[model samples]
Target: MALKAAAALDVELMSTGAFSIDQLMELAGLSVSQAVYRVHPPSAGRRILVACGPGNNGGDGLVAARHLSQYGYEPTVYYPKHNKNELYQRLSKQLEDLNVPFVNDFSKALADTDHVVDAVFGFSFSGEIREPFPAVIKALEETEIPVTSVDAPSSWSIEGGPPMSGVGSNFHPAVLVSLTAPKPLVKHFKGRHFIGGRFVAPSIAAKYDFEVPRYEGVDQVVEVMPGGKALVR
Candidate 1:
């Protein structure tokens, strides 16, 4: 259900012309930053390591790193597969304008940052883990630093959680921000969960028969997991 719903929602979102890729990524990234702040604020520690891939999910991470930097948090981006697309180039330029450092050593970045935002993968991810990312995911799994994954954790399936053993088995993020809606794999998640996409139209949601949790006041994100920690601001 989650995999199908996610795929359908993507199609609907793109086909309706209601939102552009930039708009969607901005909103999603903003929500991801907010979720990270709620779970691990700058006061905890200022340094943030945003691990990114080469897809839209990586774009979300790049945007989040910029927002986090504006919020007084020092963010470093670790993007292995640098995208050449104009959209991603723009995102990279934005981060570069902020003077945010982009690193190549995942282990070093992981050891240096206070928190990690796992935006290496999303709902559309499939098949076995590829180069660079397997090492990145392994580093994430071994790290003690708290992680906040954007949409879905890296290497996790949209329907199933982490694998029973091996690489992704212990790669649980401390906080998760579900974009558009919570996927079925979320049921297996054991930590704080928040819904991030605020642009989902009521008609579309109804059409899909999925509930978008009510956000508080003007907040872009809403906590869905019971007994979750309070929002920072």
Candidate 2:
């Protein structure tokens, strides 16, 4: 219903609001970068390999790479599918402009990184894992590095928790950044879970019963503590 509610809000905004998906992508990426920085502050020359897909989730990764670069974390992007989306291209260009390298070799990327931001898939992923991604997800699972997944961990159900087989057996991420609000999968997570995207209009939020965590201080991402104490305003 989050997608439908967003569509409805887009109509309500008409031309009066910044309803573009790219604008929301920027915010999403910003939130992910901020959360990653806060959760695992980069050390001198610490590297983060952001595994991005071809969709908006990848755009989020590209955007996060840009911000992570600005924050002094050496972030490399491993975008397998470009998909040629204009917004995604623009976001990727922004990252390249910041000197973030797009490394194609997943094995090399995973080996060299201290952390991984799993933006390879979001809430809509289903079915058995495919070609390169199955291998990529496998690499992510095998690596001992901590991973901070954006939206939801890859290879998991959008409506529920982890997948029943394959890499999911070892796909426990260290941190999860749930845009807008935490998903039902949050209940199965034991690590630090954060809620981002606080710009949703009150009417939209109320209509969907989207209870979001209030961002603390100047941070745009707020940690959703256990017991569902998600500090909603």
List the lowest-lDDT window of 10 residues for candidate 1.
Answer: 224-233
With a 3 Å backbone cut-off (N, CA, C), the pairs that clash in candidate 2 are none
How well does model 2 score by local distance difference test? Answer: 0.79
TM-score of 1: 0.94
Error of 2 at 86 (Å): 1.3
**Each prediction's TM-score versus the true structure:** 0.94, 0.89
What would the per-residue lDDT of candidate 1 be over residues 1-233, giving only the tens digit for each residue?
A: 37877888888987873788888999999999998888887789999999999999999999999999999999999998999999999999999999999999989888888999999999789888898999999988888899999888998888888978877888888988989888888878988889886888888888888776667888899887543343453
Whole-model Cα lDDT per candidate? 0.88, 0.79
For residues 70-110, what per-residue lDDT tens digits would candidate 2 score against the true structure? Answer: 98889998998886867777787888788889888999888
- Which portions of model 1 show Cα errors greater than 4 Å? 226-233
Please list the residue runs of candidate 2 whose C-alpha ends up more than 4 Å from where it truly belongs after superposition: 1-18, 230-233
Q: Local error of candidate 2 at 96, Å?
A: 1.7
Candidate 2 lDDT for residue 204: 63
